[model samples]
Target: DQQVKQNSPSLSVQEGRISILNCDYTNSMFDYFLWYKKYPAEGPTFLISISSIKDKNEDGRFTVFLNKSAKHLSLHIVPSQPGDSAVYFCAAPYNNNDMRFGAGTRLTVKP
Candidate 1:
């Protein structure tokens, strides 16, 4: 089964706090990992990615960590702003042609 699960459908945080989103995969063959952020009615934008060969990747306020051995990954947003409120998707592909995605986690940051 090709299921990437985001158990929490949504998360809420106050401004200037750290927001964390978790992801899990059942397939062991997955070799690449990506995190995408989306605003309504638009395609997702790539936030951060980590190859299976690495354990962590970071960009500005965003950070992604992968634990291949445990089949888990997480995205962390530091001092999350209201602008960061959106849906986040975890994606992966074993062959690089098609990527499986989590249902998505919607984050809300209060002002």
Candidate 2:
């Protein structure tokens, strides 16, 4: 059983448009949530995160919202740029930062 699921394998969007990525989880033990952005073969980098106790977290053009009651989370980017095109992953804290990740969501910020 997949403890976490990101239904869409990928997404594409134009530059300056908004990009949204969604994630869901079945594990109730998860307490911390994080979003990571990655490009090609490079390792993922932490973007934004939210705790189970909070509903939302934001940093500049990136924002993450957690709905614990529904075990759902999303990442939103406003006016995405061409440089923003990449795969994004949703992660949850477990076993000393052993984060469980979604397959990924690819955003194509076409210029």
Candidate 3:
């Protein structure tokens, strides 16, 4: 069974607008949430992460909000720029070696 899911295959937003990406996980064992961004052929780069102990975490223009009760999490990018367009993946690790990744959501920031 898929532990993590990104229901929307893609999302589009105009420049300078807010872009929200949603993720859902079935595993309650996951205690940490991670977000990664990948450009075409490049490896996914870590964006931000949040611990289950915290409801929200933010870094600059990016923020991750976790709703433990709902088994849901979301990444919000404020004033999204064209350079921010990429495939964003939500991940959770149950242990050091076992990690679950949501099917990425392709974000298109139109200028």
Task: Please give the CA lDDT of all the candidate structures.
Answer: 0.92, 0.89, 0.97
Instruction: Write down the TM-score of every candidate.
Output: 0.95, 0.93, 0.98
Off by over 4 Å in 3: none
lDDT of 2 by residue, 55-84 (tens): 999899998999988999999999899999
Error of 2 at 87 (Å): 0.6
Runs with alpha carbons beyond 4 Å of true place in candidate 2: none
Worst 10 residues of 3 by lDDT: 94-103
Regarding lDDT, does 1 or 2 come out ahead? 1
lDDT of 2: 0.89
Model 1: per-residue Cα lDDT over 1-111, one tens digit each: 647999999999999999999999999988888899999999999888888888888889998999988999999999899999999999988575888999999999999
| Model 3 Cα RMSD, 1 decimal | 0.6
Better by lDDT, candidate 3 or 1: 3
Candidate 3 lDDT over 40-87, as tens digits, reads 989999999999999999999999999999999999999899999999
lDDT of model 1 at residue 10? Answer: 99
Better of 2 and 3 by TM-score: 3
Give the Å error, residue 33, model 1: 0.5
Give residue 96's lDDT in candidate 3 (0 to 100). 92
